[model samples]
Target chain A: MLKFNPRNYLKVTNGAVLLRAEIEKKMDEVSKKEFKNLFLIGSGGSIAIMYPFEYIWNSTSSIPAYAEIASEFMLQSHKQFDENSVVILSSLSGTTEETVEAAQYCKERGATTIGLVGEMDTPLANIVDYPIANYAENDYAADSINLQMYMIIFRLMHNNGEFAQYEQFVSELEKMPENLISVKEQTEEKAKEFADKYKDEDYHMLIGSGTAWGRTYAYSMCVLEEMQWIRTKSVHAAEFFHGTIELVERDTSIILLKGEDATRPLAERVERFAEKYTDKLTIFDTQDYTLDGISPEFRQYFPPLVLGSLLQRVSVHLENKRNHSLDKRRYYRTVAY
Target chain B: MLKFNPRNYLKVTNGAVLLRAEIEKKMDEVSKKEFKNLFLIGSGGSIAIMYPFEYIWNSTSSIPAYAEIASEFMLQSHKQFDENSVVILSSLSGTTEETVEAAQYCKERGATTIGLVGEMDTPLANIVDYPIANYAENDYAADSINLQMYMIIFRLMHNNGEFAQYEQFVSELEKMPENLISVKEQTEEKAKEFADKYKDEDYHMLIGSGTAWGRTYAYSMCVLEEMQWIRTKSVHAAEFFHGTIELVERDTSIILLKGEDATRPLAERVERFAEKYTDKLTIFDTQDYTLDGISPEFRQYFPPLVLGSLLQRVSVHLENKRNHSLDKRRYYRTVAY
Candidate 1:
């Protein structure tokens, strides 16, 4: 039997912080004129690494940025490159064929390639101009490293001319490493309560609207399906009214990520939806922060990048509710083509 | 009392032929330019319209082309545009916020904009330099116009320059409109079978992979949810093997869009999946095709586009199966939005 480590959240959160700091330290050395675009490439959990960074980028500098499934960037037509473009290639295993190929393609196209990896030495690290190494001593699939790398990039941009005005946001982000751990620890009782109450259900639905849309979409549909062997789907709250609410029954479970801004109207609607199915709705919201301050800019978006760590924690506890373990790699083959 | 006239597949086939001819005529004029990249933008069904064109472009030409959801495109940075680019904007309404915004953005960035629309009088038609209008005399939403416009575009590209090699393919497409009609007549039985067999089930899953992936993803996940008031989820067949198959049970309903080509292996897997449930599977294959020489270039990709019409047929039939007359509109609501 696996022993439950009480510090799971702290370890993961700290790892993310250190990872971010290390990446930013190195990025401080690179000249601003070197690259224009930052292509954050990954898939599955590896892709989640860039979400916070993407938010930071969109919030601070209008510097063009995009994230693609590594395979898509490599296989699709991506001629939008100059020597001045920076390609941040991330893969926890330092393998992920698509990310590897994307890194190679960027280098071939004369773009500056930056490697974010869990291992000190790998094909990805060897190919890129700069490699940020994370030993990934923890078995959390390098989420910490991914988070750290994104933070580093974000902080570097913020500290530099790109996002000088956004220094406060970076500082706020800096505070999250500790807050995330605290939140995860504090939320365990609530999560356990949620899992115990609704664990027997066969299906899970996650709903969100704006910015949180991608995260909820990724977590409920992709991550839960990939990690927990859960049959899950997500929808925009407004869209939920369009049709999906009919699928809600007393036995069905709905996880609503209300975040900050766009919560009230959707919350009221979901309250009615929950009443119809009585005792089937679960909401994850940042308690202390109102819609105004916590997510001042894209407040209507989901907040899991900061608070979603709690969901990640709750998901692990809810594994017993699933048909398999939390880390079931059934869908992924060891030998990637 | 409403009098029912049997749909003449032959006339429908002829209309498909005319639509293809018109789109092809336009493609002949457009393909002369040397473009390094092509981006097709649309939302919902309009994005579905680009399926066949992307298939033809991928198979016949060396140039890179792709169709992306307009909403996703809007979130990304677009400082990487100048000339030698082609952007095809598709939206029947001409006012889909995302598409309209993208059209304006693409135009501002110097990418040539071509509008494919149902209404010649709409803003999208007036905004673009070259607009191909497929006016739907009666229909409000994009039912016939979408298919007609795509067929025209594919045929024109097929006839242009080095594309002449696929002339036989174009001829087969010319015959597809008739095939679509015939298939619709045939699906009357299958749709009834689907409705009777699976209507009581609480969930529905639509599975496809590769080129067909997007269509199945959009239709079962997006359209069926919008139209049928059903709980449907779309899964890439490969991903199904990853973890989704565990959700299957004796009562579960699965719709497999088995397009021609590499889909067979996955289809066979799904067949076994259906058998495990003792016959709860409804599979749609290329028997829906009327034309034989429908170019096997991107065989894995093209079949789903062909199935677009087939899905519509099934949807209507499923309504009859449920003893519900299809409601075209909600009270006092305009379809224009």
Candidate 2:
């Protein structure tokens, strides 16, 4: 477990889990209001994190949800966004220019705004109507934000009468901090092996579907390209056959983030194809890990959290094996654009 | 212009324009009916083509529009898609398996389904409630599909009382074929230069925003990766700063698709950054072309069409300069997955 701190991870994740009461109260208030639609806005990893919730909300609830990039959302002048709309935005630093500006934009439009941040009293937190803060480092922020999102979003769905199993789901979620630690422990060895094996691989294709798609996208752009400086293409399983599948060669690295959702079959299709075409196919299926005290029915909702925790292990190993600082950046925040 | 076919382009684009009367008749019926939302469903390039319309719809109309991948849409069982949903699908060959299945899925749910195809009696055309066919070759397919999309989508917005200048817009659209020809003619030399310059580049970063985003994604994946076996990372200009920008270096090839839209500033920001960071920066701005008979006020809506026509020239030059056939594929339709 290179650079891994289990105790700190638990502390950050527990902090997020402990926000359940406050998140519940805020979600209850917003859910009681009549909103036409929900806009989930953020930048980069933040926006990628919202994709799973958007997919979940669209599939399970009558309320429509849109996951939009903060800058694009600000400029689009979306006709669907109005006073009756609810906007949820996140920025771990709470100082991300685009997210903060988007929060201000939503406030000006008289929409209900919720902010998720790693610290309190930041620009984003100050502008949002409901600001939920938790302390977490970069390695554990995904687990923290995702944990809080599960509490807020599912509660909203419960209030909408779309999810009757909320109590059971949250009960299972409460056990995740401990279970996710075990997931990291189990994945550590494999992550190390993967990093050791593919440290110098120039390009890779990461494919996923359903809830896992966000993790696939974020891990490629935010981690592989941005963190490790490795080239990668993150394509949805359904989109693989369309164009990207043609890029597959015998030695091409293909990483499949498989989760237990309705779209699992789509990922399986890609796995079948990749197995035939490439020798460097890697499948990170959440089904291989057993979360103690979690129901099988709830596994569908656990991919984002589970995959996040597992990938954190992979990130640490990649940094160790590649001898590249995960925090190193060539231009981002280094120079003014 | 290399590989240019003016007569065939006019015939295909005019066919789409001719469909306006029938498209209006069908859209009038759908608009008169009570509908909850619009679902723009397709696979790969089909879904990519729907993105601009989705953006336009969200910006101009109160009606919420979703652009969903066909296979994932079927599996997700999106709650936003119901009997009151107007589902639009396209499959050029009218035989994309996922798209046909999606049309069936929507039909079984009693949703209004519209299919745009190259043939009238194919599976997708036969299954959809309203099928609009306009024969086109690969080079002109984008033009044909985008032309019909402008007509149908704008008419839908007009019916929703969101577009007051639909007549003038359509009139301008009628002049697009000839104007688009001029765009190709003007861009021919630059396209050839770009192809000759970057024909051997292993990878490229294609950045675009707003209406040009879809073209960026499609060109990178569908043309570069699939057709030329050249790796590419197509990122939205807004999202470029988030993660992908870190990958840009002095010799890194960056293609900027600049379109006139609310998000034009986002592209400009990327342009400024790439100018300073990379010497291999190529800009294909629709503003460079004088679209005769098109009002300045209407130029914003023409980027997708204009970019599509302009890129067709790039495709022809790339094929010629690289000595690679655009239709040749290693996997796509060449082998069974």
Candidate 3:
């Protein structure tokens, strides 16, 4: 009777939505400044959410944008910072040690720091100069606010549509919460099916390429690694083509994230690759027109974001099916220097 | 009948050795400032071989290093370079479009460049400012030469170390060619044992961590993917604790590169992990008692390069068993921005 209950995760997901909306409003209202660059600090899911924003922002602004998993930069060279730099710090529970240390380092070096999180009362929220609360209270994979906040940031970035139309998109986002609930249900059902079949799989390899490739990085390290205690590895699909693809044979259950963007073709290729080995290929296509003409907002960003949320639910569900409790001790552990 | 032949690979291996020796001598003569940072660039095996050198150099001198496959970097950010960088480009065939473009990009940007290759007159060798020929005419995994050149570079990094001891190591290296012939026989036998059990495996997962992790990265990408055309994935062992390890099943094959280094202990942990799912596990330990007694070259600088060569040999032998020809082409279509 190991049914997956995402009650704890749901509350944080709700909080993250609120926090992200607030931060987007704040960033938008601020006086526009001519700046040389934008720097972001957050690793794992927190930073990954920034990718869509970075991609959108880089297209519009002349300012150069750079980011590193806060822990990764700390390992190598240390660059001096100043007040003019715009720095964003994000964490779901708001307690990742690396994010906190990076925040402190940036603050000490006089960088204008903005913190985003699902938790309102955590030390990270208290210490950061500009704290935007996603309002999450507990630590659970289902409660991850990374995507919720990321969607808001991406929506805001779309405000300056160098790529496509935005008015309809913004209006659609206003209705996303209700629409998202339905998507979540479908995702949960699919996850349940997957968990039933693959629950005993002791090692999992999640592979994707391009922007989604980084998704593998975080999922392997954060979700599958942290929550499930499963042996997992994520790699870019093209890199996968380099040598590892040779090991693919029947019996390898692979999950491929089919990004609806330019990376869609690569996903398709990987799906074909998996077929060569076995039929146990899970290909997530974000463009299924099942809802066909759904709200304008739901159509644009909801595809991948909805899929991502579902994948999160699936991972947790799989963990539950295995009869393992979610462990968040590492989440609370002091971010190692 | 299509049979895997080592004759072509052997010729390339010889060429790689001479090419590596030339690069070694050239590096010794190059001005220190010109060699500011050792930028190792290539795809697959070339990139894999340089990991040990990067690890070793970073061991002593705080001289910074960056190692990346040319194709991956070219797809995204290319602005991380400046005029003062020293680019060390490696390609077994003196082809590989990405390395060629990277070398060209470096030359155009006023960076001193060096080429390590299997052929003297190949396009890659012609494009670089200093091209060192390994004399490896055939591009089939530049086996012996890859390690030989790496050892020379490792020695060069320790030029400031005790010369008397360095000379002794050189004497040992002179003996290494013969040593490798024996090691080749040993690894060949081991590869046969592994292939007998797992060559028909539909899925294989290889795991390593930290410095040694690069070999797994390279092997999974180059040897396993390119040569075997099998679905393979490599992962950091530390990350296994996070989540993906759950994919391991009674059917999946797991290979652990249990080298005798700090990360060796990590192999045992991974072994325990593999046992949780199935008893199908293999550990390859570089039982180098002599390596321990030798003057400690920085792990970062030495291990990957040394281990890379050894691993390349193993991979080539495995490819031989898999009945795949190692004729490399299609270098990810690299073009300069």
Q: Each candidate's DockQ score against the native complex?
A: 0.18, 0.86, 0.18
lDDT of 3 by residue, B36-108 (tens): 4557776566776666555445444434456655654454444445576677887767777768987887788
Put down candidate 1 lDDT per residue, B270-300, tens digits, no spaces: 6666665535677888645554445555344
Query: Which candidate should be chosen as best, given DockQ against the real structure?
Result: 2
Q: Identify the candidate with maximal lDDT.
A: 2
True contacts kept of 3: 0.29
- Any idea what lDDT model 2 has? 0.91
Q: Which of candidates 2 and 3 reaches a greater lDDT?
A: 2
> In model 1, what lDDT does residue A73 have?
49
Best-to-worst lDDT order: 2, 1, 3
lDDT of 3: 0.58
Evaluated on chain B only, what are the TM-scores of all the candidate structures, in order?
0.82, 0.98, 0.79
Residues A107-135 of candidate 1 have per-residue lDDT tens digits of 88888788877776798998888887655
Evaluate candidate 2 by giving its C-alpha RMSD to the native, one decimal.
1.0
lDDT (C-alpha) at residue B114 in model 3: 78
Pairs that collide in candidate 2 are none
Query: Model 1, residue A297: what's the lDDT?
Result: 51
Instruction: Please provide, for model 2 over A178-248, each residue's C-alpha lDDT reduced to its tens digit, 9 standing for 90 to 100.
Output: 99999999999999999999999989899999999999999999999999889888888998888888888
The DockQ assigned to candidate 3 is 0.18
